[model samples]
Target: MSSKVYTTESGEVVYAMVAEFETPADVYHAAEKVRDAGYSRWDVHTPFPIHGMEDAMGVKRTILPMVIGVVGLSCAGLGFLMQWWMSGVDYPLMTQGKPFATWQAFVPITFELGILFSAFTAIIGMLFFNRLPQWYHPLLKKDRFLRVSDDRFMICIEAGDANFDPDRTRALLEGAGGKHIDLVEE
Candidate 1:
């Protein structure tokens, strides 16, 4: 049979292929198969968390913690430098006969700066990494996808994946016991 392509009303483009599953276990195993098959641009949705889903999906650790650590350290260093320059080099203030550029005096501010910067970095990094503040998505247009918040589980393989072929992807979903397979359009 000839391969059929789905398009938007304006003939825009196909977004992804969405498949429904009845249980978390079904979706979890399906995710493993999709991952092992070397499809990178795919995701699973379920009503509740499933244990070991990350391993099944081959999801790697996020770099947010690394980013936060780096930013926190850098900010702390800057805070120390600012205090040193102001007290020792810039202002040259002599307080209570204590030597200027006193290391002890900078500890609190340095720690505070590190904590503050780390907290901010965590928030911003999370938003950036998650691609958040996205008010709209093509998947929201699929009525069946709304069931994901209820009892249904789903997997969506994006058309952007290099290995994505309409017929083969559909067949793969079918083989994985995915039902209500539909092509979403952008």
Candidate 2:
């Protein structure tokens, strides 16, 4: 079978093979087949999250929680230190006959800062991990793929994958019950 190729404005010949499935189950099964075939650079898109689809796509758990945990703790500690330095050493204001570095008074601000840092870290880390803020993608040009937001399911295997072969990948997708297979250009 001849693979469709598209030349970009930059004169690059890179292309992506997209297989459209009629149902989420078909896409999920196709993802499993693609994963088992040792193709690492592939993605599944659906109208909504499918049950067990992550395992089918061989996606692993992310480390964003660890990042958030470290950032939050650091911010909380910094907040406590700032409060201590300001009240105990910088200005050394004495209030209600109490010691300047009162741990009790620092608790509220420290907790609030910790929460704020965690929330920020979570949002930033998610965007970073997911590679968001992408205004355009090659798949957006495919007319059939527009239904992915409503009902269609799709799996795209990039040409850059180490194990990618246009004919073999197309056959795999076909065996997995994919329809409307098309080549996407970058």
Candidate 3:
């Protein structure tokens, strides 16, 4: 296979090596190959979700759950503290001989704050972790990649991967039954 020389204006860099596959099954198997080859910074894109794709790609569990848990508890604690300081310390109020600092009155607010913070944390955390607001991508410049949102499946091995080698990566993709393997630039 002839290596396609991709030239761009000064400072333009190769972003990734993309491979096109016809079906989800092909992409799934190709992902397994790429994973076994020990290449990190790779991704598979499909028109629709495929079961077991995460496992095939060797994706680890995310820590967003732990982050949300901590944020939720902290907000709940703050809610309780705020209520106690206001009713008990700042301004003492007694009605019907009831104590000024009542834990029961704080339950609803505390629970609500916990739920609210947790939900916000989940949204913000997911966006932060996924690196959202990406206005542009090198792959978007490829006309063939447009099929990715419709019927084609693709696997991209980023040039930043430690195991990445232009020739070897292209060969690997071809061996995995990938067609029209192209080098994307940034």
Candidate 1: Cα lDDT at 39? 95
TM-score top scorer: 2
In candidate 1, how many Å is residue 76 off?
0.8
Once fitted onto the true fold, the runs of candidate 1 whose alpha carbons sit more than 4 angstroms away are 1-12, 47-49
Whole-model lDDT per candidate? 0.91, 0.88, 0.90
lDDT score for residue 40 of model 1? 91
lDDT tens string, model 1, 1-186? 125455656787898999999988899999999999999988998888799999999999888999999999999999999999988998998779999889999999999999999999999999999899898999988899998998999999988888788889999999999999988988
Best of the two (1, 3) by lDDT: 1
Report lDDT (Cα) of residue 11, candidate 3. Answer: 53
Candidate 1, backbone clash total: 0
Model 1 residue 15 lDDT? 86
Tell me the TM-score of each prediction against the true structure: 0.85, 0.90, 0.88
lDDT of 3 by residue, 132-179 (tens): 878798888999999999999999998877778888999999999999
Regions more than 4 Å wrong, model 2: 1-12
Worst 10 residues of 1 by lDDT: 1-10
Candidate 1 has a TM-score of 0.85
Number of residue pairs clashing in candidate 3, backbone atoms closer than 3 angstroms, sequence gap of 3 or more or interchain: 0
Best by lDDT: 1
Give one digit per residue, the lDDT tens place, for model 2 in 47-147. Answer: 98899998998999889999999999999999999999999999999789999899999999999999999999999999999998787988898899899
